[model samples]
Target: MTLAELTAAQRHRVIAGTFTDRVRATKSWDAAAPVAGWTARDVVRHLVEWFPGFLAGGAGIELPRGPGVDEDPVAAWQTHADAVQAVLDDPATPGRTFANPHIGELPLDQAVDRFYTTDVFMHTWDLARATGQDDRLDADYAELLVTGMEPMEELMRSSGQYGPRVPVPAGADAQTRLLGFIGRDPSWCPS
Candidate 1:
């Protein structure tokens, strides 16, 4: 379904929650891939860092000052999660705006779903390798990955942002293929 087709509740319940399930598993061998100097705990902290900004004023929040409270690193994570859940619960907040990278224009609801779709989908492996949980991927999500990203593979790879492609095993599942293409070492971690 196109992004406009989904509701805020669905975005929060299905999409965002799924991302939480996925990202909560990520761990880095060096303990900092998800965020500088942070492990899996730190990665969640990172996503939580930006959670509140997704709803902007939709959460009935004053704009948080600065990049948030960095000293209390885990607090930023907790606050962001609570704020994101609040946006999902409030029907009036769908049209809100969230800040993000290269996402262009979109309302709060769409952005929230997109955040779940893009970040969680890819990071499923980032966490897998970072923490060594490759066998634990959600199979259902892996199947839909092609619909979400394959057609634009060449374009994304050519942009120098996604980087040179990695070859996929012949006839592998879509998730493995997509992860390999996006500069992740499907067979090795932290390459």
Candidate 2:
């Protein structure tokens, strides 16, 4: 499938995942997420705060700022998600250039796929795990991400976007391997 098609599919999954997480977050926003020190509310907040910049930088479109998660987590996420979806849906956005610090100038669709799309997919797991929802990542998708990211692992780690690698068993599943590669422990849980 084309990058836009793939990203659209990923976006759908992210929206569904966020919906599920939001319901769980209502139960307990203070619940610890799989990510160190971040609560379930923080999981949604992170997306709210970061996605706009990524979409703006890649699509070259200015988006109006919306409510912070502290103000209204669900509305904040929905607003950002809708804005990002609008940008992704725009026919004129694909061929535009985005100057990324890590990858230099790249086509808008390519940048979104590499940077933002994958982030949504990965963080879906964090939100799910944080809120006692199903956190099992799709193994096929994990493998695809691993293949795309392995070559740039050093650069990504050095950029401080990812933490130190967590070792997994040799026979671990694709999701476990992918999590380890991204410096997340597959076995991590809130104590």
Candidate 3:
């Protein structure tokens, strides 16, 4: 099913599953990633470290702690993704509200789906590229995201979440346009 056609839980499962596959496939946690100074391990670390506070602060939902990324990137990511899935799977979570100073209030599921799950999806490419694996994103979903974000480019850049858009060829594929819009060089590789 298309990303827009999936429920929030299903969306997270699909996107996070791709990221988990990349995490498991990684052979070098310390390898430099496409994002300037970040390593493969750092990609997982960013997902693991950032979301818990946002979840807790907004929804009062605390994710269980897992092994450090330095110790085991696979286990660390698995734990974090599982915890997020559990929250999504919880029956009560659908009705819950998530509110924080920054984004105000949104359904807990939408908040997670919009912010955390999508982050995992994008970073899957980072982890994959860092370790020389398949780095292609789902083209339809990439198109969907780029289409949705195009109107918000100025705000997205101002938020410092996205960098200045990089130029890509006019006939570039959806994923290439997405990477360029997000300030990622579509052809990046570890040195």
**How far is 149's C-alpha from truth in model 2 (Å)?**
1.4
- What are the Cα lDDT values of the candidates? 0.54, 0.73, 0.90
Residue-level lDDT tens digits of model 1 in 98-147: 55455566666676665544554465455545665643444455555555
Model 1 TM-score on a 0 to 1 scale: 0.62
Q: Give model 3's TM-score versus the native structure.
A: 0.97
Which ten residues in a row are the worst by lDDT in model 2? 1-10
Higher-TM-score candidate of 2 and 3 = 3
117-156 in candidate 2: lDDT tens per residue?
6787788777777777777776677888887888988888
TM-score of each: 0.62, 0.86, 0.97
Superposed model 3: Cα runs more than 4 Å off: none
For residue 160, model 1's alpha carbon misses the true position, in angstroms, by 5.5
Cα distance off (Å), candidate 3, residue 20: 0.7
List of clashing residue pairs for candidate 3:
none
lDDT of 3: 0.90
